[model samples]
Target: MKRLKLLVTLAKKGAIGEKVKITLRELADELGISPQSVLRLLDEMEKEGLVSKEVLGRKTYVEIDHEGLAFLESLCDAISEALYNGVIIGEVISGIGEGAYYVKQYAHLIREYLGFDPYLGTLNIRVLFPKTVFDALCGVRPVVLPGFTKDGRTFGDVKAYRIRINDIEGAIVVPSRTVHPPRIAEIIAPVYLREALNLKDGSRITLRVVKG
Candidate 1:
């Protein structure tokens, strides 16, 4: 399980760079493994050239190799598909009848699985992974669904979904503005709901869940 996580980390980061600078103690905590186990994993990864370590004075750092990055991305894409339920829980913010908005802070960070539409240009979803699923993946990787973009990168909204339901029972949202465009922020993935939203092949524009 611990070995699997290191591999996942490599896959997600693309490349770990020449000097991966997390302390041994931090690494252990972040990976949810023992420090001793970390040493073992690092040793194995170094042997494989999946990672390379650098020592600066008394400090040590490690980063993923190019080959390791490629390997991890493929694995992540596959795991993402099979790991979670298909049903996605969210609301379309822009469509909200009048004056609805998801708080910006909630939308931007990995607090909850909130979903907002482009209507707000940002979103937040309370992380809603089930305890069982989340627990199983405890050390598999740090939280955050695969492929979510922060850092002001925009794709062609190609992965859009035509949400069929307007179930805003507990969904909260904010409106659009110049500084903050509407977006899906708070999103929850109920297994069956996610399965139902099982995106079809080549379907673009993921459903912007938070909409007023």
Candidate 2:
């Protein structure tokens, strides 16, 4: 698991150079394992394409490939969401913040100006991808909007995103902005939900309650 974690971390960061790279010997020393053992693990990962290996003269260079990246990106999200719902995020950022915008699209946010260590975990966000945003986008593409407001406004000016999200669980509607499981669905941007309801464009700003 240690070697796998190290490999994935290095690969995801593209920690390679023109000369090719191998596991850092310092890393092996710290992990209390010989470089040979690390090599064996890399060999196994290479067979799976989770790691790619190149034999150059007397050295073996290994790095993460696309498959490994997908896995880690998924991991980053799972861990982040778990933290978000588990004793981490202090207050319900009920106003517009990052989650309401892009994580739903790029699966990553790219801002570094915020004072706090920007939550670097993945959002457990899911988009039902409604007809509006999907239809309007150039490729009929689905995107997560980051600029949504907390009091049920929206991610952006165009609330036509087909992105519907659960605002309720089992039998009850979620109370706005406290803490709840990602599964419970209380804390959602109102705009995205509204679009999914096929609203009249500028109708009664009521949250479109979906049948959970």
Runs in model 1 deviating more than 4 A are: 7-15, 83-88, 91-212
**Candidate 2 residue runs with Cα over 4 Å from true position:** 16-19, 86-212
Estimate, for each residue in 1-212, the C-alpha lDDT of model 2 and write its tens digit. 77556665565446443224654475477556887777777777778777677877776566677777777779877765443321111111233344434334322222221111222221222212221211112232222224446557553422122222244211111223424343222223323433343433223221222211
Report lDDT (CA) for all predictions. Answer: 0.43, 0.40
For model 1, residues 106-185, the per-residue Cα lDDT tens digits are 33432343343223322232223322222222223223222334468531211122222234222222212222223233
Worst 10 residues of 1 by lDDT: 155-164
Q: Give the Cα error of residue 31 in candidate 1, in Å.
A: 3.2
Candidate 2 TM-score over all chains jointly: 0.38
How many steric overlaps are in each model, in order?
71, 15
